[model samples]
Target: MRTFRLYGGFLGAAEVMTKPVGLTAAWWQVLGAVLREPLPVSGIAREMSLTRQSVQRIADLLVERGLAEYLPNPAHKRAKLLRPTGEGYSAVRRLTAAQHAFTNRVSSRVDVDELRTTLAVMERLIAALDEEGL
Candidate 1:
C-alpha cells in the first residue's frame, strides 16, 4: 500500500540521519533509556527489549566516545550502572530540540489535534503489533 511505502521511506530517512552520527536505531534507543536514569546493563537491555550483548556493545561505544560513564553499582557485583556524561546529555538535548523543531514545522501545515490523534492511533497500532508478537 502507498501508506506502507511512505512509512518505510520515512524509516529509511531516519536511518540515514543516524548513519552520520555513528548510531543505529538500537543505539539511539539505548542511549535514550540511559538518559532517563543510570541503569545496569541488564536493566538497559530489558528496557529496550534488546539482547544484553547488543546493549553492551552500544554502551561501550558510548563510553569510548566520552558520551557515557560507568559508575559503581552497589546492587550488582558484576554490573556497573550506566549514566550519560555531560557531552551525552548535551547531545541528546540538541537532538530532542531538533526533533521538536521539525515536528513544529510539519505541524504548521496541519491541525495540531489531528496530528495528536494520528500519533495516538499509531501508538495503538504499534502496541497491537507488540502484543501480537510482531
Candidate 2:
C-alpha cells in the first residue's frame, strides 16, 4: 500500500523530470540502466524488473531517436549491448542534476536518521523477497 503509493509518486516525479529532455519515465529508466555499461535488452529487463519485450520496445525507440545505439556483444552475437549516445549522456546528466536538487529539497524536510533507517528496512525487505522469490 504505502510502498505502491511511493512508487507511483516517484514515477510521476520522474515523468516530469524527464520531460524537458524529451524523454518519458520509461525511456529514462531504460537509458539509466545502461548508463554505467552497455547491456542486452534482457539484462536491462532483469535489472529493472520489467519484461524483456517492454525494454526492447523502449530500446528501439531510443535508437530511432538517436539517443542510444546498439553495439556488438562479444559474449552474445545476437544479444547486442545497448548503450547511450553522447546526446543521451547529456540528457542523463541534466536529469542527475535535477534529481540531486530534488533529493536535497526532500531531505531537508525529513530526519536523516529516519531516512537511513527506512532505507535499511527497505533493503532488507527487498533481500528477503528476492530470497523467497516473491
Candidate 3:
C-alpha cells in the first residue's frame, strides 16, 4: 500500500512537471524509453514494462504530434523503428532539466548513500517478485 501510494505520488508529480514541455507522463515515458536509439513498439513496451497495444497508441500519437517518426526497419519487414524527432529531443531535454532540478533539491536533504541502498533494495524486491511471476 505504501509502495502504491509512493508510485501514485510520483505519477502525479510527473504529470505536473512534464506539462510545461507539452507532454503527459505517458508521453514522457515513451520518449525517454527511446532516447538511446530507435526501437519497435514491442521493444519499447518490453523495455518500459508496458503493454504493446498501449505503446502503439502512444507511438501513433507521438508521430501525429511530430514528436516521433517511423523509419524503415532493415531487421524486420513489418516493424518500423520509432525514432524521436527534434521536437521530441527538445521536450526530453526540458523534462530532464526538470528532473535534475527536482533531484538536486531532494538530494540536498537526503543521504546519497542511503538513496543508493534504497534503490538496491527496490531492485531486489522487483527481482524477487519477477521470479514469482508477480
Candidate 4:
C-alpha cells in the first residue's frame, strides 16, 4: 500500500537523519522516550506501542553501552525504572539539535497546512487500526 511505502520511507529518512547524533534510529527513539521521565521497560513499550521484549532488549543494550541506567522504583520491587545517563542526555541533546535543524530546513520547503492534513489523516488511521486490533 502507499501508506506502507510512506512508513518505510520515513523510517529510512529517520535512520539517515539521526546518524549525526551518533546513534541508530531505534537508539535515538529509545533514548528520547526516557529523557524526560524514567520509566520501566514495560512502560516504555506501552507508551511507544512497541513490544516489551524489544524495549527490554534495547534497554539492556542502553545500559550496557552506558547510555542509560536502571534506577530503584519505590512502587515496584522488581521493575526498576530506566533513566538516561549523563551520556544519554548528551546524545539526545545532540540528536534534538540535529532534528531541529533538519526540521527547519524541511519546513521551509514544505506546506504547513499539508503537513497538518497528513497528521490528521495519520491520526485517523491510527485510531482505526487501534479499533480493529492487530
Question: Which residue pairs of candidate 1 clash?
Answer: none
Q: The CA-based lDDT of model 2 is what?
A: 0.93
- The segments of candidate 2 whose C-alpha lies over 4 angstroms from its true place after superposition are none
Q: What are the per-model C-alpha RMSD values against the true structure?
A: 3.5, 1.2, 1.6, 2.1
For each of the candidates, give the backbone clash count: 0, 0, 0, 0
lDDT of 1 by residue, 5-121 (tens): 976876665565556565655556777898878999899987666789989998999999888899999998889999988877766665665567655776799998998898999
lDDT order, best first, reads 2, 3, 4, 1
lDDT, model 4, position 121: 96
**Which portions of model 3 show Cα errors greater than 4 Å?**
129-134
Better of 1 and 2 by TM-score: 2
Error (Å) of candidate 3 at residue 114 is: 1.4
lDDT by residue for model 3 (12-31), tens: 98998999989999999998
- Candidate 4: misplaced stretches above 4 Å? 128-134
lDDT of 1: 0.78
lDDT of each: 0.78, 0.93, 0.91, 0.85
Candidate 3 TM-score, C-alpha based: 0.90
Best by TM-score: 2
